[model samples]
Target chain A: MVNNKGLLIVISGPSAVGKGTICKELVKRGIDNLELSVSATTRRPRQGEIDGINYYFKEKEVFEKMIEREDFLEFARVYDNYYGTPKKNVMDKISNGKDVILEIDIQGAKQVKRNYEDGIFIFIMPPSFKELKSRIVKRGTETQKDMDKRMTCAFEEVQQAKYYDYIVVNDDLNSAVEKIYCIIKAEKCRLSRYHIDLSGFKEEL
Target chain B: MVNNKGLLIVISGPSAVGKGTICKELVKRGIDNLELSVSATTRRPRQGEIDGINYYFKEKEVFEKMIEREDFLEFARVYDNYYGTPKKNVMDKISNGKDVILEIDIQGAKQVKRNYEDGIFIFIMPPSFKELKSRIVKRGTETQKDMDKRMTCAFEEVQQAKYYDYIVVNDDLNSAVEKIYCIIKAEKCRLSRYHIDLSGFKEEL
Candidate 1:
């Protein structure tokens, strides 16, 4: 019998690549024995957001203290707000045989990769840069200058996808989810992650 | 657009472990863009066996000459019979983007590993040695001494599974087939095997 450990799947993509949507669909499909890691942030919670559920809302001082204590797996400061992944939450879930998905940006994913080399890194990609631009424009949330900056950032992000373990193109939502589901299942069968206990069989022989 | 190359999947297991059944089920289920590699053997074919379908029946001298020419991806001498995988058949199919599955014994698998390091090696496993013995006994084709020899050989074969890339336990035939299918699909998504042409995207950006 092989009692396999859980997998730490780190997902990264540029803005408007549908990484969040794919993750949501995977959770909605009820992937067996999986959990979404909750991230902590120093930003204010939205009206409908609840503490510990939507995000682990933290004060600036408290977030800085945790950072100093090395309690975060990866952290960053953006526009005076700190966002980080809590190390304990991920470690506890994985140790208890729950596959954990960390949906982060490329920079954060790179930092986590340094600490967890065995983690499966997946980069969600748009079908093309043209489609990516269209999607961003369709969102109607950015100015022309903002969109240009985001497109440049996306170009740089897609370049780093070569370093990731796998890349799923987000042309169709359901199809992308199915591809990711297959990747996770196949990864579980990898011999590097599984160790068969042949003691009982040896005894019979 | 990533026009990925086909995968060379090498499947190996102990005798009577249902590798043939799983491969048949995979084909029956219509695994898209996949084919089973035809093996070359010097042994005499049984009744109903076709020249190029079941096996490529070859004369001993021809097989020997092919071996001298290094025409086999892998080959071995079993008793007085020469069994081998022709390099051309596998290479042709894979080069055309058709995934090829090679079902071979452990010894032949090890030889293939040395040559095709990029190929994915998968080991099929019986649920237990006790169940394995029962299955072999149920087949009703082996004498008592022959059965004992097979059981001993199986023990040694299972031990080599640790070197494989993936392991699928054949507790249920359909489940094993599904696991292998997932492995093939996931391998296609691997960043190393797949290269997305970003030159077009670069022009658009």
Candidate 2:
């Protein structure tokens, strides 16, 4: 029997919905209580990115081997790199009282939720598609062509909002973060987990 | 399709657990947005108790007739008084976006949960059984025997703590109310009802 079951929170959003930034803030506030599940990737590390911290940087051969051995809970290829989550580490952390946060994409989130029915999925969205496009453009990295592609991608992500356990509109940073915090706090108190004994009823009566 | 489904929150505890006072504060805090479910009882009204507001004062035959017609969600006899919840009012309020608050005993809470899977049950416990007993005694309505019976009832209620979606310890009134408030606010953010569309994925790729 499990002494304590940890909750897995899968967070997904479009590229510029500020999921990463808000996650960093969540971590800064006190994520020591939660284990941030880092993904293993075959992509080359960008400048100033640490190997393990940024990702479990792995060779294509090694990444493929894990897939062959069925070591990953879920894996997918995006752009030119293969990304996957290791199952054992996440489960162990959760069983040990650390809630695990998985900042994965929508596809990966759906896959995880299917396999782990208990996991909570949160989908973040911009206030409006126009706002989303503006934020993506403000990043200053995408070319005009690339910007169009990303905005199109964001609209698609917004459509997946209904599947999430909660939808957090990243209209304002503090408000969104506060909403997420409230969700977590409330989930902790869910009645399904409470063990009430009615033996006292018979004795009292 | 349901236009708006209101949430059902069951607040239950032993006598002197401060459930009544806390619920009062919660109502004052705009839970009027949630309709407070007044129970129907066959007991004669005490002075100043309103006919339909405080409770639906009923003749024993009328109460029995309603029970026979399956008009109640749950009902029980306590000290020769018949008490029950009308099934219609709750369903009507929920369909109108008014969350329903049921302040009942633990037994009623458990029964309601069994019938209404969507019902959210919250258990309020005093700091300890000893403290609970003291409070009940200090109320002066109960003799030693009555106090003992109440303590026994409380112990039984506490055992059902695990049955609730949330547990709030009423050590301090303000903080406990705040905690309850947070739980309710956060529950609204649960992902089950909310949806985010990911159709953007198809467009981008």
Candidate 3:
């Protein structure tokens, strides 16, 4: 008896909660059967970005069409640009016994939870409100009004943490990574995930 | 905020399935906040057994009265002796922020689940039927008739594994111990367990 399929892991929080960095570290640990889910975007690629490697670039019209056909697991249009996780890419990897992790914002996480309640939903939390504000301020790219808006958004997202299965405080980087890694290992032991073949045990008896 | 109460962890399987061994190893790992729940039994303690260390030796009448008062979390009468887990002992530790683990048989586990569904239930499984039978035979204390009865009981217990939250196979002792350790750590991260003080994170902002 084996777990024939992999788990769908969603890491979510406010924009500056460090979900991206944690996911990067987990992937770089060289666990062979784990993968990060890639998103399709309607925005321009950056200088060093590759077409399929960085993001699945699509025209706005084509992205809207895919949304109509439900090709994306979760998608949202933000200030004229569309971003979404393609359903096929994530589903195929899971079927092939590779755990696929998605680092998305609160809205997309809620969408994925609605569609698949069995996936592991983890909410990464900043140590405190002060720390969250400082992280955003350190980026030094936003105006005072914009930073205030982001902090308000972060406050709203922190309230949504209760809905997720696990809440990991992103206080220490190594400790946070270790906790998430433990969560992944523990999920593998869940009885709901395994197709236990007890028939052979009984038959041989 | 901290999780005010500790988790009630139940490790269960058929007799001789190594549930007791795993629990011992986990406690011996010196996780300071973890403790094993001691059972009160009407049977005479073996030579050199301490009163509260190995088992809480109890008189039959006292055990019966306690059961009537709903003092035991779960209890059962086996062959002439009454064995049970005292509710106060386990609950007090949990209230003091120490996780209490119970290593019990399948029937006792069922009773605990009925009383407290929030507890973490883990089932220990042998690698295969052949390995299970050989382990029983190697014990060399049971008669042939008793051995057959125990094997039949084991076969029945395997079917109940589905009802548990996690299933750990005892193929390798170290691996099984490590998996259970990870499970404990992950459970602490569960949203339901933590008294999340997001209120501070919001109010301070």
For model 1, how does the per-residue alpha-carbon lDDT over B1-205 read when each residue is reduced to its tens digit?
7755788999999988989888888878888888888999999999999988889999999999999999999998989999999999898888899999999888889999988999999999999998899989988888989988888899989999899999999999988998999999899889988766788888988
Q: Which tens-of-lDDT digit does each residue in B66-107 have in candidate 2? A: 999988889999999999998888989887888888888888
- lDDT string, candidate 1, A124-161, tens digits: 99998899999998888788899889999999999999
Candidate 3, which segments miss by more than 4 Å at Cα? none
Q: Which residue pairs overlap in candidate 3's backbone? A: none
Residue B67 lDDT, candidate 2, scale 0-100 = 90
Q: Rounded to one decimal, what is candidate 3's iRMSD? A: 1.2
TM-score, each model?
A: 0.96, 0.76, 0.94
Give the per-residue lDDT digits (tens) of candidate 2, residues A1-205.
Answer: 1125677888897888888887777777784466678889999888888876778899999999998987887899988889999888788888887888888877888788777878878888777667777777788877878877777666666677677877777889887777777666666666654444444444434
Q: Rank the models by DockQ, top first.
A: 1, 3, 2
lDDT of each: 0.90, 0.77, 0.90
What digit string (tens of lDDT, one per residue) describes model 3 on residues A6-75?
8899999998889999999999997658889989999999999987788999999999999999998899
- Candidate DockQ scores, in order: 0.77, 0.36, 0.73
- List the pairs of residues colliding in candidate 1: none
Best by TM-score: 1
